[model samples]
Target: MELEVYTYQFLRRRSRISSSRRRKSRSISPRRLKSRSPTPKRHKRRKSRDSMSLVSESSSASGGPKENKDDSEILKIEEENKKRRQQEAELKLIEEETAKRVEAAMRKKVDESLNAENIKLEIQKRLEEGRKKLLVEVDAQLEREKEAALIES
Candidate 1:
């Protein structure tokens, strides 16, 4: 009987501990849910307001002739840099175009040379054929003359 009472007491204490843990977990989850809902909006508003004030304050403080002069000088430097970059780009394009033109001229020269060589070869072939034809005609005339002499004799 005493052992049964002890077992009952242990089971009751375990149930109580589990119930308390469940309550703690439930309470913590709701707090986290509520805090996460509105934190981002509030934080963003605060940051934007802070940044705007800082910008206004700095602009007001630095609103002077010296600042304007510095700004103009910076602008001039930027414009000069931009012009230099544009000139460099133009020079690069001109160089590329020149290279292309030179390459095309060299190709044209090579083609013309090849065409001239072909023409020379064709002329030589035609000359050789004409020479052969003339030789054949001369031989035929000599044969005719010999035949005529024999007949006359």
Candidate 2:
């Protein structure tokens, strides 16, 4: 009887120790959970700022004559920019045309110079060839005359 009573008390003490450990692991307070939620709070603040900026922009667009005037001014500036671009294009075309004329004139002068040089070289070669042919013909005629004189004498 005494041993059974001691075993029962020991089992109860073991169960109490385990239950205390479980309680310690699972004990979370609502205040601690709320403190952990501030990260999401900060994200909500950022979202609110974005939404407020959108609302303000929408409200301002829904207001009076300032928006119309601003759009017209923007359109006018675009027209002026288009005109300037057209003028620049025209200037570029004129410059290109002038450059083409200058290049053509330069090419003509170079061609004339090359033609003159080629003509001079051809005339010199022809004159040399004619002189050589004349010498050869004269030599042949002299040999023929000598042979004829010898035959006659």
Candidate 3:
């Protein structure tokens, strides 16, 4: 009666038995909602009622085509499962993207700090070299002045 879409998620394994039978059976089979497990007599009474319903269905089947009630339930369960899987997949993708963004931010912060430390070390090295050159020049100037004073005397 209706068309369905195909997806890779449906390609994976699925349960042979549909859980919707128990999950939504209240709508499909109301009589099953009430249980009389503690009382055997009530259980037997329910079984008899079930048998009577089956007998009527069998007679109707003989008179005409049997209704595909079970088939509709199976379709509904399949759709429910697919929708749940799609939502879960979307959530997983979102989580992975967030984690990647955090990792990239952390890497950028570490690289920035490392570059700052390297620049500080380079400035200190240049300043030390300049101080050494000035000390050497001052020592040469003092020796020249002393020689001049001795020659004049």
Best by TM-score: 1
For model 3, how does the per-residue alpha-carbon lDDT over 17-117 read when each residue is reduced to its tens digit?
36443232323233343343436876888888798678768656544223445545667989999999999999999999999999999999888875797
Tens-place lDDT digits, model 2, residues 32-60: 43333546876899889798777667656
Better of 2 and 3 by lDDT: 2
- Per-model lDDT: 0.76, 0.75, 0.67
Q: Please tell me which predicted candidate would have the highest lDDT against the true structure.
A: 1
Ranking by TM-score: 1, 2, 3
Error of 1 at 20 (Å): 77
TM-score of each predicted structure versus truth = 0.38, 0.36, 0.34
Model 1, 1-153: lDDT tens digits are: 765565465446545886436333322433343323546876899889798677657766667557767877889999999999999999999999999999999999988886897877987999999999999999999999999999999
Kindly indicate the candidate among 1 and 2 with the higher TM-score.
1
The TM-score measured for candidate 3 stands at 0.34
Tell me how many residue pairs clash in candidate 2.
0
